[model samples]
Target: MSGWQRVLRGMLDILYPPPPLCALCERPLRHFLQGRGAVEEPSLLCVACEKQFAFIAGEICHVCGRPWIGESCGDCLRRKERDFLFSRSAVRYNDKMKELLARYKYRGDRKLAEVMAFFLQQAWRLHYAEMKVDCLTYIPLHEARLFERTFNQAEEMACLLGKRVGVPVYGMLERRKATEKQSKKDRAGRLHALENVFSYAPCGKYDLPERPVIVLVDDVYTTGTTVAEAGRAIRTGISGAQIYGLTVAR
Candidate 1:
């Protein structure tokens, strides 16, 4: 950047200083740093707050990638045929994860995108990186919902993960309308409500990548209906493509 631009940015920073504390605990990050070497790293939460994030570590379902007692989960078997090859979540959607999602998705903390994306990346590395995902995409929000939320949290995290992992993020799927809020419904209700709620043209020149595998990113995975519908839409539109789902939590 030019010197004038630098000077202007400095002046602007003086006029509107950014927060230097953790998003959740509101503690200054410097207090948690281990040493001078740690000062250069960026973090949304302090060490204590970060520790509260419960990561999934043991044998998981071969399909949904959720913690399971056996080799495969009954939910996956019941579904039998699914749109995506598989899905994985970084952490169990416990109380801490809920708070993180609430702050980022409901409270409009855009800066939290970095932290969430980092967690998703960790999940991918642990489970799905071997899939050789050619492209990264997100479950798009409906126009009305997008307008109401002012941003798509999934897209933000997808873009960040794509940049970090050197994959290209694409707008491959679009929601048809503002369907009933999934949170308000049960699993069956959510599945019924999500049917045909996304539109995609897999054959479109801009839709398909040279590589066939794609990873779908989202903030959370609940009933698996939304991503399954998205994957179905992609497969219906494009032939011989593989789909995978990644999320910060399940």
Candidate 2:
């Protein structure tokens, strides 16, 4: 941008200062709660607002990232096979998270990518930090949807995560089938819809690592079908691949 544009932006920032507000709840974050450590870095949400998010921690199902309430979640136990080693998410898909995602994704607010990626980084630290994650890649968007949305939310978050975590993000996957939206579908419908949806994209000169430990990134993990399908497709293209799933919410 030109210097004049930069100056104008600075003026605007001074006139209408960016609010130090929580992303989920528009409450001002400037007020530090009493007895809390004020020296700590400020997060995207205020203490009270942040408390509202149900962060996924403790014993979780390896397949679905849900709290292990039973011997094994029915979804993971019933499935005879899965391509990905495991899947995990940062937070629960609650109304607050949904609203944040809608603003970032549907409403074209790209700045929220950083906040979303912050949680993703935490998820990685909790789940995949010790694992040998060779490279990171994100779920692809079909051409039509890509054109309509103008930006891939998953890709944007993944790039930010890659930078934060020192992982090399690669564009090695593509959505070959523009399947129907899975949000409204039931488990069976979602499973059927995701079949053969992902395909491997050729990477020029970036030779595949031997028995690569790949982590597939996505915005949300409703059911494991999408990531499983993606893992299957990637394994088909690359030999001896171990796939894993990471998402912002479960």
Candidate 3:
């Protein structure tokens, strides 16, 4: 954050002392009290506001976790459905969530990530028992992107997750090819452009552990293109392990 922004936020923190403030509403909390040290858990969102970001439910697609009004989303209904076991994000990518995410991703708001990490940790606890992850890896930014941003948002999320879950995060995979942003492409274009873009390098600083199970971590899960392509490379080059995926958004 810039010097002025930090000063203002610091002032706010002192005056407000964080929560009981709603994570979604940004209001002082008088009830529903849980916090990340000072930053509150997203649970501070009042029940009425919480309903706007309903959890995924019913007849959802088996792969991408798209909310199904009837049977499945169009992409998941296609024959070439994604192969990863299903997925769930913490909350809907609503205006509030997107603004908070952009603050961390675009505006260098590290403090916001701490609050988000706790929220993500809650979601992980909610669903991970059924998922049973064996190993954990994160999608990496291309070297150029990493240098420009000075941090990969996925890596930041993974850092917090590693601390929360006590699972080691492998920097085993490398982004070998710099490509156009996935958000710029149609689904077919995104999938095609990602082919061979990610490479796995064994014999890193940490030795590969046994059983070979892993959860691929990333900050966003938009269309599932990045994780699917990254997982394919890992299966092809690394150990033949089942891959699970976790992210802050879908």
Per-residue alpha-carbon lDDT of candidate 1 for residues 105-164, written as tens digits (9 for 90 to 100): 988988888888878877877776566777888999889888989999998999999987
Instruction: Give residue 156's error in model 1 in angstroms.
Output: 0.7
Each model's RMSD to truth, in Å?
A: 5.6, 4.9, 6.2
Expressed as tens digits, the lDDT of each residue in 1-250 for candidate 2 is: 7999999999998998866877656787776443212223457778887777788888788578888865568889998888988888999999988988999988998878888987898788877777778888889999999998999999899899999778888877888878887898888899988888988895654555799998999989987888999999888988789999999999
| Steric collisions counted per model | 0, 0, 5
What residue runs in model 2 are displaced by over 4 Å at the alpha carbon?
1-42
Cα lDDT, all candidates: 0.81, 0.84, 0.70
TM-score of each: 0.82, 0.84, 0.76
lDDT of 3 by residue, 123-238 (tens): 57756745556557788889998887789888778878888778777776888888886678887798788877888875366555553667788777787777777877777765
Candidate 3 lDDT (Cα, 0 to 1): 0.70
Question: lDDT of candidate 1 vs native?
Answer: 0.81
| Alpha carbon lDDT at 153, candidate 1 | 95
